[model samples]
Target chain A: MPSVKFIEHNGTEHVVDGTNGDSLMMIATSNLVPGIDADCGGECSCATCHVLVDASWVDKLAPATETEESMLDLNPDRESNSRLSCQIPMSDELDGIVINLPEFQY
Target chain B: MTNIVIIGGGQAAGQAVASLRQEGFEGKIDLIGEEPSLPYQRPPLSKAYLSGALEASKLLVRPEKFYQDRDVATHLGSPVKHISPQERTVTVGETEFSYDKLLIATGGRPRKLTLPGSDLSGIHYLRTLQDVDNIRAHMATAKNLCIVGGGYIGLEVASVAVTLGVTVNVLEMESRILQRVTTPFMSDFYHQLHTERGVHIHTETTCQGFRGQSGKVSHVLCGNQEIEADLVIVGIGIIPNIELAETAGLACDNGILVDDHCKTSDDNIFAAGDCTNHPNALLNRRLRLESVPNAMDQARTAATNMLGGDKTYATVPWFWSDQYDLKLQMLGFSQDADAAVLRGDPGTRQFAQFYLSEGKIIAVDAVNSPKEFMVAKQLHGVAVSPEDLANLDVDLKSLVPST
Candidate 1:
């Protein structure tokens, strides 16, 4: 199984195993990691499951679609590496992914 | 050690436990719910869960392990019978539990039709997981499905049932479908969309009663005409579960009245979710919204305030409804708007209805057009003319202050 690291805004870290079929939000949430709200349950509608990806691993992930971008644009704290974790599918390519969670979801 | 007790088993209950733990409360947290399972999201029940595209486990906001890992004791399958604010105690079943602070997240129940033959076996509602399971079971061999009240639940169920080869008849008491929440243009859009997909929408039709055979619903009688239906589903609206709070002497109107901080009449008790009629700081009015965003946001606020932090919930209300392939996203309420503009063409199945009050944008209904929705979200206090709104050629991102 691939592993993913979630770092909270306070610098607390939680490393969890990610399965191939589950999304990053599911992994973070199932591990009881704080900060990923997943309000819409991986529907790509609510951008609450936001994660700021590390700069080095930004291009390793798929680019966000227009719908996701539109959802993220509603967030005032969205950053350049901002992505809805629910939209990111877990795969072997994302084994050592580092994710930083925003301080507040809403 | 301090103890915190949360009532109800919906999104707010689950989020409260998570929020309390995240805030480092370290108190004895107990989440007692009427349902047998963990706190789950109800949004997908009408859409993906009804269509069997989403499973029951996926609806949970957090799994059981999270609650256990956080030392949050979950007592499921029992409803809180009484709340004694004087002692800060809640009674569930035969056991009485005391609390230092309490959260009433008791959601709402589907409003049921009290007409004749309403006790039939095949009649169903789509509120909980078991309700959908029952509806799906009835749809297995059932052909004609009569849906009462053409609201979000009724229409979303109609779209799913019709697509699954079930003949659907939607009976709305109003002159048009979704009359309460949307304009005629949006209603017409949905009417056309559902009609194209083989759904029989009967507007201005009232369901009189259900005629059944062998204690099973066979037809829905509407005034003089009776429509044959093997199964009947009612989606008129939801009555907030405020009875629990009312009996406990909390102020109740259409919903449990709460302040902007989610604080109820009692200082030791707070409320959130669909159960609370809360004041919106942004809108400058009180509203009882049945929305996931409100439930989640208010849960955070209530949790922070529970921990002695000053937090106020002033989020501009937003809601979404998924029917067929169209995702209807609405920001704020458009009822107070005097002028409305149709941004983009509805023929392309992508446009937004911008509603303005006093020549300033107040609310919007975006259909498959999320860019305009994002722009509309930031236009709460900004003043803009209707021409600026209708002009889609200009990038909507440029109209607002860039984040």
Candidate 2:
């Protein structure tokens, strides 16, 4: 089973087992993890589920499409590591992924 | 601790609860939801949920435990009878709950067509979860579904029906689909897409009445033409639920009117989401928006003011719709635009149409082109000539002025 660690802005961490077909937003939210709003319900339309990927695993994740990049650009606090958690599909290869939820999301 | 009461069981009310908890408001939060279930997403009620691709649990804004854990008392399936602003109490039957602050997020209801045979057994309107459940149940034994309206709801249902192998016929009174909300380019794009999917689209046609058999809708009458239909779905429009605000002596127009801070006429009361007619400084006009983003954003603003924090909601309005794998994202309002420019070709199924008023970008409707929509959202009211926009060499990112 794949596991993803979600770190909140206040340093609270929640490591939950991820389902293969679900997005990170879905896993974090369904597990009652705080700070992942998924206000648009994993539609990739709202960037509220914005997360900063750990620097070490940035190269391993799939690159965001132009549409996803547009949504990320709307976030004022967006950095090179910023990704909409809804766009990242959970898989066995992406286990042990670490994502930092932004302060603005709360 | 203050007693904060929230009315309505839709996205606005649910988001308000989440916002209050996120803001650390440890008050006695009372959520009065008219529906039996928890606050769920309405958008999927027509698409994924209706098609059975999305589960009912996924539609909830938050799990039931979230509210229970926060000590937020929830009253589901209870309709608020009346509100007394002077007494600061909301009445649900004989029970009266006092509140220091109140939020009215009643949202809206679907407008029903009152034609002759409108009360037929097989006719349905897509608004609530129950409404879609009824439609989904009917879809099992129904074929040749007739949809009356070409708006987002109508089109979304048509998409699902087509996927379910149900023959669909869409009747639009307007000349094109989405005439009231989108540009002709977008309308034509969707028209072509749906037509290619084997859905019959009838434009400039009005459903005069329904022809029924045994109190069930069998066919639809449109100016002497009777189209066979085993089931019928109406998605005309919605009327904001504002009777409570009006009865409470708050100002009401087409919807409950609110200022920039989401405060109503009375200081103790606040209104947000689809039930609100709010002033948008960016658009330089007042309008009511029905979208998830609008509901969530205004709920945040209303929660802030409810907690004694002054925050104004003046962001650019944005909306999105998913139909047959195409995602259309619109930014700002495009009403009364003088000119429109096509940024890309619709044949490719990914393009954007920029709406400009007197050489200034007012709004944009992007089809699977989120980058263009993002650029338009940032430069919403900035003056940019159509010629400059048409130039392929010029980057939309460069047009955005750096803060």
Candidate 3:
């Protein structure tokens, strides 16, 4: 199982083991994380599974495609490190990665 | 005074700007949108907009002058490329505009198929005026249309296509149409209704690719079946625009995560509409809804918070889709409902299916029954005895809140 760390807006950190091929959004949702809604079920249709990749892990994550990029543009707090967790499939390479949860999702 | 800037030309952004002004905020308002025309309603784009019953000009939520009259600096056709939260500014091409508060209502884009022959001349995805124009032109000469998805957009477009003497074929990858959003009973009701109307629906069908002639789509290849088509409308779904949010340093979840107050990680910024994910009080969980009601409701909540007013948005989720002569209205989340009670005849296509969980009304999907829908919306989350619901003379409205 791959593992990832989730850091909340208030600086709380949670480390969880993730299933392979499961999206970061699914990991957070399955864990009942307060954030990470994943409303559109990882279809990239909804931005509910947005997360900010830790600066050090930014290069480790894949770049967003046109569909993901267009969806991110609709987000209010778009930033350089923002990535929709649903679009980021979990793998061994993403182990030990850290993500910051937004304060609110809607 | 706070300087608030909103991006996107849609109902959500327009409502946010107007709500801000209505709330007595004397802040500088700048509405930057990529659409060359004024903000308009998109639901009609797949329905009335294609039927010629609604003119493009009338689709505008408010006239062009309405923004100027309301003291909003409107920037039509301008798309924001970057955001500097540290500097409280957004850069659109060569122009850099500053803001104390920002709202992103960039909305969504229709998903386009990338299969072979997808770039063919007759293939299209409905998202904007340009797509609508192409579809309208094709409608004039086309006789058969193959819709790739059986969701709201596909069904609504089929409704219009059938009315205009066009033969329609809907392909659904799932065994039943609307399996993701609706109950099995509701799906059966709609399936029967469409079948009776001479519409051919193929379930459990997977599209292999498209066959084209002279750069124009001529057939949709699904398994061993070749569906002849003059036009193909793909309504797979939409992706929310979150690139700008990700480019900035804000925290993002499935959407720009906001608390009950609609504030993102940054206190100075907010997100609403289809680009946000917030907790649904009624569902007792977090969700991202794409309906117009959710968008408008969240925009108001974001606007209020931007003006120093803290208000938590907690409304029951509801959605309505019109197809042919049937109007399907659904309320609450039915994903977990264990039992569904039918209130009318599905054969007639005029009924309501109430989804129940632990003897509580969790959701309701009504077809051509506005009265039942009205009652169901009020009965959401309420503990109702199944016996009382089955009784035809019982007035459910009497049990709801006064307000």
Candidate 4:
């Protein structure tokens, strides 16, 4: 199982085991994390799963696809490092990646 | 002077902006949105947009010039990064914007399947212009399509697919289609209608995964069964965008928590649309709704409050879904109704299901009958006896005020 570290908006940290093919949004939502609504169930249509990638590892994450990019346009908070967690698939390489939650998703 | 900022470019946000302006508020108005285009309506995305009955240009809630003409500073493609309640500011990228009032109208997204091959090409979720564009291109050549989930989106898309001479198979995890929302009568009516149209429907079946060929979906795996398809659409449900609210120290339960006034924990900030959980006065409890009626009503309330007006959004919630020739419209909330009054024959396809709770009309589910729905909406608070509701000869309009 791939493990990912999540640092919530309140600075609470928790490590959760994620499957290789699951999305970061799914892992966070299933773990009952305070953030990461993953509304739309990992579909890039909704930007509720918006997360700010750890600036240091932003390059390691894949670039936003056209769908994700278009959806991000509707997100409340748009950042250069902002990525829809639903579009970010979990993997061993992203184990230690950190994401910051936005102040409003809907 | 109050500085009002709205974060969204959809119908709800548009309504809020318009309401605020109409209320004669002489304040700073900032409309920050991620969409490059102006605010638009989403209900048509699954229907008219797919059938070419409506153009993309007509979907916009207002013309581009309207924003400038109305003095609404529109920020296209700019996402709000963070909100500092203490500082009364919101950050978008490197720029920090100040606001005395904030409205969060971020909407929901379409739910996707977790099965394998979901990442393959030709899989679609209809929520925006680009999504419609991609699906429209494939729909031109698509012969067979598999729809996972039997909700409104799936059914609406299936209706369009069948009309285009495409074979559609709808797979539902529940025992009946639309099990979560509609009554069994409505569900059976729809199931029969779809089945009669030669649609292949599999109920109580879970999608195991998907099989792909050449990076495109070819088959859907359901337990030990396999169904062939050229396109796949998953419409399980939507999740409210609550991360931003939760992160900002706002109360969230299924959605951003809001009172009747659409106010969040931070009085300076408010929320509406599919991303909010508001107190439904009719239900006497907090509930999250996905209907356009709820969104627009909440928007109005939020706008009034933003303009320093004392108004509460306590309107009865309503929703509608168009499938094939049937238009299902609902009024109020019915999740806890103890009795239901049938106005007409369900088998005939024109009737209204009036849900009653403790001898009062709580909610109504009408199919192909808007007059009854309108009457139900008007008589929402008036106590009507079920015996009178069951009588067909009695004029329902008489039960409530005219107009």
Looking at candidate 2 chain B, the ten consecutive residues that score lowest on lDDT are B394-403
lDDT of 4: 0.79
Model 2, B1-403: lDDT tens per residue?
Answer: 4899999999999888888887889879999989998888998888889889988877888677778878989999999999999999999989999999999999999999999999999999989999998999999999899999999999999999998899999999999999999877778889999999999999999999999999999999999799999899999999999999999999999999999999999999999999999999877789898888889889989999999999999987888888888888887777768889888788888878898888888888888877777778667778986876776577776776654
Native interface contacts retained, candidate 3: 0.00
Q: Residue B26 of model 1: what lDDT?
A: 95
Backbone clashes (count) for model 4: 9
lDDT of 1 by residue, A36-103 (tens): 88776788876779899989889998899889988887677789999999989999999999999999
Error of 2 at A25 (Å): 3.2
Flag regions of model 2 displaced more than 4 Å: A1-23, A26-39, A59-66, A73-78, A89-97, A102-106, B385-388, B391-395, B401-403
Q: Provide the DockQ value for model 2.
A: 0.43
Give candidate 3 regions above 4 Å deviation: A1-106, B401-403
**Candidate 3 lDDT score relative to the true structure:** 0.80
How do the candidates score on chain B by TM-score? 0.98, 0.96, 0.96, 0.95
Runs in model 4 deviating more than 4 A are A1-106, B401-403
Candidate 1 residue pairs that clash: none
